[model samples]
Target chain A: MSPRSDTPSSPSIDESRRGLDLGSDRRFLAALILLGGTYVSLLLAMVAADLFYTTPGHLWHALGSPEIRYAIRLSLLSCTLTTLLSLWVAVPIGYLMARFEFPGRAFLDALLDIPIVLPPLVIGLSLLILFQTAPLRALETVFPVTYAVPSVILAQFMVACAFAVRTLRTTFAQINPRQEQVAMTLGCNRAQAFWRVVLPAARPGILTAATLAWARALGEFGPILVFSGATRMKTEVLPTTVFLELSVGRLEAAVAVSLLMMGSAVVALLLVRTWSGTGLAGVSSLRNG
Target chain B: MISLRHITIQAGSFNLRDLSMEIPTGSHTALMGRTGSGKTTLLEGICGLRSIRSGSIWIGDREVTNLPPGQRGIGLVPQDGALFDHLTVRQHLEFALEVRGWALERRETRSQELAEWLGLTSLMDRLPAGMSGGERQRVALGRALAFHPPVLCLDEPLSALDDQTRGEIVAVLTEIRNRTGITILHITHNRSEAERLADRILHLRDGRLES
Candidate 1:
C-alpha cells in the first residue's frame, strides 16, 4: 500500500492558505487601528457635543458675565503664578536629583512622586490638615492660605510642581554631564557653567515643563475645591466656574467654560509640541556629534 | 611642573592605584596603556575631574588636590573633543575669558589670537556640529589654551581621526608645543604618537605606572 495524504493537496487549497496567512497577519493590526480610532473618535465626539450644546450667542453671553470673566482672569493669573513658582522649585529639585548623590536621595525621589500618584482630593485634604496644625496654622493667621486668594495659587502649584519636576529631571538627565564638566575645565565655576551651558541646553525641556504646569493648574478642580472652596468672584477658577454653573442648573454656562478650557489646553499643547520638537532635535544632533 | 604623588582612584570596576608621575614644566609626557588600562582615569584624576582616594597632586608649587578643576588652572581636551554643541568656535574660546571677567576688548583680542594660532580664524562663527572631526579638535584645543592654563591634559585627542587628519593634528600639536612651551600630559596607545610627541613615556599596566 502506498502512503496517502489525509487532506487534499490542491492548487486552490494552496491559494486559500496564502489568503488565510495574509488575513491572519492583518487581523491584529486591523483590530488595533479600529480600537485606536474608536478611542479618538469618542473623545472628539464628546468635545464636539460640548461645542454644539450651546449656541454661539449663549456662549458669548455666558463668557461675558462678570462671574465668568472673574473666573477667567483668576484662572489665568493664578495659573501663571503657579507655573513660575513650580518652575522655580522644579529646576533646583530636578538638577539635584539628576546630578547629585546624597543621603536619602532615593527616598526624596520617591517622595516627589507622591503628589502625582496621590488622588487630587487627597492632596487637598493633606494641605487642609497641614494648615490645621500649629506652625502652619499660626502662619495661616498672617498669610491666610486657607480659603483665600493665595490658596487658589497654592493648590494649583502643589500639583503642577510635581509634573514640572518630573519633566525637568528627565530633561537634565538626557543632557551629557560631560558638557558641564568641560565647561568647568575651561575655568567656569559651578554656577557659571550651569547658567551659561546647561540652562541654554535645557531650554526646550523648560518650556515644555512650564506650559504643562500652567495647563495642569488651569484645569485643577478637586484640590482647588477642597482647599480653596468655590466662592463667586473670589476663589473661583475655570474648573470651579464649571462646577458652580452645573450646581445652579446652568448647563450651558458649564459647557461654555469647559469649551474655553479645552481651547486653552489645545493651544498650550500645540505650543509645547512645537517648542519641544525643535528643542529635542537640536539636543539630539549635538549629543550625536 | 605637574606632579602626582601615589594617587589612587576607583571608577566603577576599574581601580587606578599608586600612580605617581612628574612632568617638568614645558615638557611633553605621554601616557601609554592597553585598552581599559585606566589611562583616561589617571588623566581625569590629575585634571581634578576624578577624586583621588588618597595621595596628592601639585601644579607649579601649589597643592591642587583639594582645589576644584577651575582653581587648579588645568585645561583638558577630552576624547571626541567634547565641544559645547550650542556654542560657536569664538564663543567656546571666549567662555573661559568671560568667566575670568575679561573685558570685551581683551576677550575679543584673546579669542582672535587663539583662533589665528589654531588656524580656526575662518571657522570661528561655525557651531561644533558643522565642523569636521579635525576642525572640532582644533577648536577644543584653542578653547583649552584660551585661559593660558599652566598644564594641559589631552585624553586621546587624536584617536577619533583618519590618518591624514591625525597627521594634521599631530603637526598642530608639535607646533603648539614649540610655540607655547606649555606642559602637556597626553594619553595615547600608539607608540608612534608617543615617539613623535612625548619627551618621556609613562606606561600604565594593572593600575600602576611604569616610567
Candidate 2:
C-alpha cells in the first residue's frame, strides 16, 4: 500500500474514533446531569406549589392570626431552649466518645443513635411512659414536665440532642488530639485543655450542631402531638399548628404554617452556612499550624 | 535531671523496649532516630501522654510515671508546634502560667519576658495561623518554657523549618539552654542538628536506644 494512502485513512479513522468517544462521554454526562437535576426540581416544585397554594392575602391573614402567632412564639422559644440543652449534652458526650476509651463507649455511642433512627412517635410515647414511672412521677410533683410547657422543650431536646451529639463527635474526631496533648504538657489539665483549646477550635462544628438541632426542633411535631397534646396556645409549635389547622378544616392556615417553617429553616441554614464557612477557614489554618 | 528506668512502651505497632537513659540537669540531650523508630512514642511516654508497659520516668527528684501529664511538670513542644489555633502568641505563653495559678501581674510579666526572649514581642497579638513555621516553633518553645518546668521535651521541633529558619531556632535553643539551664530532651533525625544543639547524643534504632 502507498504510504500517503495509509496515512490519510489512519488519520480519518483516528478522528472518527475520537468523535465517537466524545459523543458517548457527552451523552453519559448529560443523562446523569438531567437525572440529578430532575430529582432536585421535583423537590423544588413541591415546595413552590405548597408555598403558592393560598393567595398572598390569605397567607398573610393566617400568619397574622392569634393561633398562628402563639405557635410561632412557642416554636421559637422551645427550639432555642432545645438547642441550648442539646449543646450542653452534646459537647461532653461528644468529647467523651471522641477522646476517651471506656468500657461502654461503643454501647453508648450506638444508644445515642436510637433517637435519630427511632420513630418520632415512639420517642414521644417513651417519654410519656418514662414520666409515669414511680421516681419520675415523684419528681413530676416538683417539676411538672409531662403535658406542659416543659414537655415541649423536653421532646424537642430528646431528638435534637442525638443529632447534635453526632455532629460534635465527628467534629472532635477531626481535630488533632496532639493539640490537647501539647496543652497538657503546657500545664493545662484535661478539662482546661478541652475548654480553652478543643472547644474554641470546634466552633464551626458547634454552630453546625446547634443549627441542625434547632431546625429539627422547629419541625418536630409527632413527639409534641403525642406527648404534649398540642393544645391551642399551650403546647402548640409550628408543626403542631399545621396539624391543628388541618383538623379544623383551615387549609390556608395549615399551608401558611408549612410555608413559615420552610422559610425559617431556609434562613437558618443559610446563616449557618455563612457562619461555618468563615469560621472553618480560621480553624483549619490554625489546625495547619 | 531526667531519667527513664527500664521504660517499655507500646504504641500501636511500635514498641520501645527496655529503653533507659538519663540526662543530667542543665544538659541538652538529643535522641536521634529514623522515621517510624518510635522517637515520638518514647518522648510522649516520658511526658506521660503515653502510658508505659513497664517503666518509671523521673524528672528532677519526682517519679512521674504514674502521674498525669499536667502534674508531671514536663513541658513538650510537639512536632509542627501544635499551637492552639484560637489563641494569640501572648495567650499561648500565658496559658501555662495561668494554669499554674500565677497571679495576673506575674503572668503578664512572664509573658512579656518570654516574648522578648523569643523575639516575638511584635507578633504576640497574632494567632498561630498567621505565623510562619519558625515563628510558630518559637511560640511553642516559649509556651513550653512559661511554667519553668525543670525538664522540657521537644519532638522534631525543627524538622518543618527551612535551613535558615532551622539555624535561627537552633540558636534560640542554645540561648534558652544557656540562660535557663533547663534539661532538654530533643528528638531529631538530622545528625548535624543533634550535634549542634545537644551536649550528649543518643541514637535510637528499631525503638531501642544505643548511646
Best by lDDT: 1
Model 2, A77-192: lDDT tens digits are 99999999999999988877777776767799899999999999999999999999999999999999998999999999999999999989867866778888888887777788
**Maximum-DockQ candidate:** 2
lDDT (CA) for every model shown?
0.87, 0.86
Cα lDDT tens digits, model 2, B1-211, are: 8888998997756788998888999999999888888888788888888789998888888899999888887889887788888789999999988888899999999999999989999998998877898999999999999998888899989988899999999999999999998999999999998998898999899877888
lDDT of 1 by residue, B42-67 (tens): 87778777788999999989999989
- RMSD (CA, angstroms), candidate 1: 11.0
The list of candidate 1 runs beyond 4 A from truth reads A1-32, B12-14, B189-196
Error of 2 at A45 (Å): 2.3
Q: What is the DockQ of the complex in model 1?
A: 0.42
Candidate 2 TM-score to native:
0.88
